[model samples]
Each structure stands twice: as structure tokens, then as C-alpha cells.
Target: MTTSAKRLDSAARRAQLLDVADRVFTAHGVHAPLDLIVEMAGVGRATLYRQFPDRHMLLLALMERSAQWLATRARRLAHRDDAFFRLLDYMASRIVRSPALSDYWRTTRMSDPRFSDVYQEVLNAFAPPVARAQRAGLLHADVRADDIPLLASMLAAGLRGETDAERRQLVGRALCIVQRGLTPSAPGGCLPGTVNDLS
Candidate 1:
């Protein structure tokens, strides 16, 4: 081990494992062998196990990392008029790179306690921006904060593409459609006349 590697404490080691695992899972799917993760991280199987008792546990850690990322990003975009849309752009970038993680999230039982916690984090991240957009007449009356997850799920449809470039193109197209639907129409435009924010 390098001198720096030797210096990593338990928490640091756990984080390092997750970082490596993120790349491995993105390339190999969540079912990729834990042994490979250990090998790539230059850590023993026991050490990996010490940080994550099992694959599910490790997956949960990754989910937490995702939620943390969303929260941090949401905070950063809080002040923008288009914060909600901007946050979605950031989310698409992450999801595109981490298809395996998002796939795992989608397949997991909705009732799972851990799943609920992570999903709630996602909801919380968008709530402020969603409300602001609605209050500002930026979003349609039918759009609600709870609807954000549905939009996110719709974005995941882009994941079907085999290539990263193809996936990005698909996500971009989907976002354009979604943003149009959520946005209030022009005067006498589609749906009822646009509700001007005027604030």
C-alpha cells in the first residue's frame, strides 16, 4: 500500500470503496462481482465486507451518495428562476453515467424502507424549486412537487440506448418535451391562457 493508502481511516476507506464501486457498477452493472471491486480498489475482501456487509448494503450506500449529490445540487441551484429545469439537467447527467445504479433503484421494491428513504431525499431535493416554479407561473397548474419523480422516471426511458451519446440525445429530447408540458403556455396558447407570474 502507498503511504497515502495507509493513511485512510475507516470512513475514508469506506468512501474510497464506494467511489471505486460506482465506476465498476456503472461499467459492469450492479451484479458485477464484489471480488472485482476488491481487486480494483486494492483492498482485501474482508476490508470491502467491513465497509459493506453485502451487495445490497453497498447498493444502499451508493443510493445515499446519489441522494447526497441531488441535495447538494438542489441547494446550489436554489436561487435560479429555472432551478427546477437546471436540477433536472444535472440529474440527467448523473443518471446517464450511472445507469446501473438507477436501474437498481427502479427495480427495487417500492415498499422497501431503504428505497423509500432514498426516494424521499429525491423528492425533498425538488420540492423547493418545484414550488417556486409553480408559484412563479412557470409550471402548469397540474404540476406538483410529487410529480417530479414521474418526470425523472420518464427521463430514465433514455437509458434504453446502448451508447452514451445515443442516451444523451434521447434524454435531451425527453427533457425538451417535459419542459414544454410543464411550462405555462403563452396568452391564448395551448391549454388555458398562461398564468402570468407578474411578481
Candidate 2:
């Protein structure tokens, strides 16, 4: 094959591996067997190794992709004038959709500088609305930009629930409490649809 053909093949194989890896990792965590991923991807071991080299490298790639997707969503959310509420709503939606955030925190090696860098990028992506809310006095006085991470971490735990119903209930409850705590007292009570309430 020509060099151009080989490059295209390599790129196609890498995309296949990532698609398989997302399912495998979600089911078995990041340490799932390399042979299993290669088999599922319908690619040879050589192709897998050529693309990812190791489990850590594959995990980092997944993190990078997920972070890019999330940054795009966050940027859109920040366009809303209600930065505080929009940030929390964005976070709540993430908690419902992505279980990997919590899984990565629990399973990945925290000491890995690459992993730490990815986590930092996620935090920075989440910071804009949080900082804006603070400046606007929309968030509680005690809240810091760093506090958004803990909120996300907690919501992520809710998503790790064993069953679909459980995950839904947990996230719903957590979001309620979060919005109540963050809202200014002037808006009635914690009832949903009220000006101050956040469901």
C-alpha cells in the first residue's frame, strides 16, 4: 500500500478502537483486557498497540475526547445570561449523561500527572460560569470557583448508582439540593417552577 493509504488505514483503525473502548471501559473499567478491545474493534493487536501503545495512553485519549465534548457544551451554556443557574443545569445534565467522570476519579491513578492535567482542564472549563456567578452575587458567598468540582463529583456519584432508576432518583435529588443552596433566599421556597426553584 502507498504511504497515504497506510495513514488512512491507521486513522480508521484508531477510530474503531475508540468506539469499542468506550463500551468496554464503561463495562469493565479502563483496565479491560487489550485483546478483548482489539477483538471487539475487529482490529489486530498490532493495530491497537500502534495506535494506543498502552492502557494509560488509551485512557488519556478517551479523557481528551470527552473533555473536548464537554467544553463545547459548557461554552454554549455560558452564553446564557443566568450564568449561575446555567452552570448548575449543565452540571446536572452531565451527571445524568456521563458516568465516566465518577468512574475515572475512583479508578484512575491520581498521581498520574497526565490524568491530573485532564482533570484540571475539566475544572477550568467549568470555571467561567461559576466565577461569573460569584461576581454577580448569584452564588452563595461561601462558594468558590473550586467548589464546582466538588458539586460535580457528588453528582457523578449519584450517576454511579446500580440501576437506571436509582441513578435518575439520586441525580434528581442532588440537583434539587444544590440549586436550593445556591439560590438567593428572595425567591419563595425549594418548590420547582418557582422563580428560585431549580428542578
Number of the predicted model whose TM-score against the real structure is largest: 1
Clashing residue pairs in candidate 2 are none
With a 3 Å backbone cut-off (N, CA, C), the pairs that clash in candidate 1 are none
Candidate 1: regions farther than 4 A off = 1-8, 186-199
TM-score of 1: 0.86
Q: In model 2, what is the error at residue 157, expressed in angstroms?
A: 2.4
**Which candidate tops lDDT?**
1
Q: For residues 14-78, what per-residue lDDT tens digits would candidate 2 score against the true structure?
A: 77788788877766666678788988888789888888999878877877777676677778778
**Per-model CA lDDT versus the true structure:** 0.79, 0.68
TM-score for each of the candidates:
0.86, 0.75
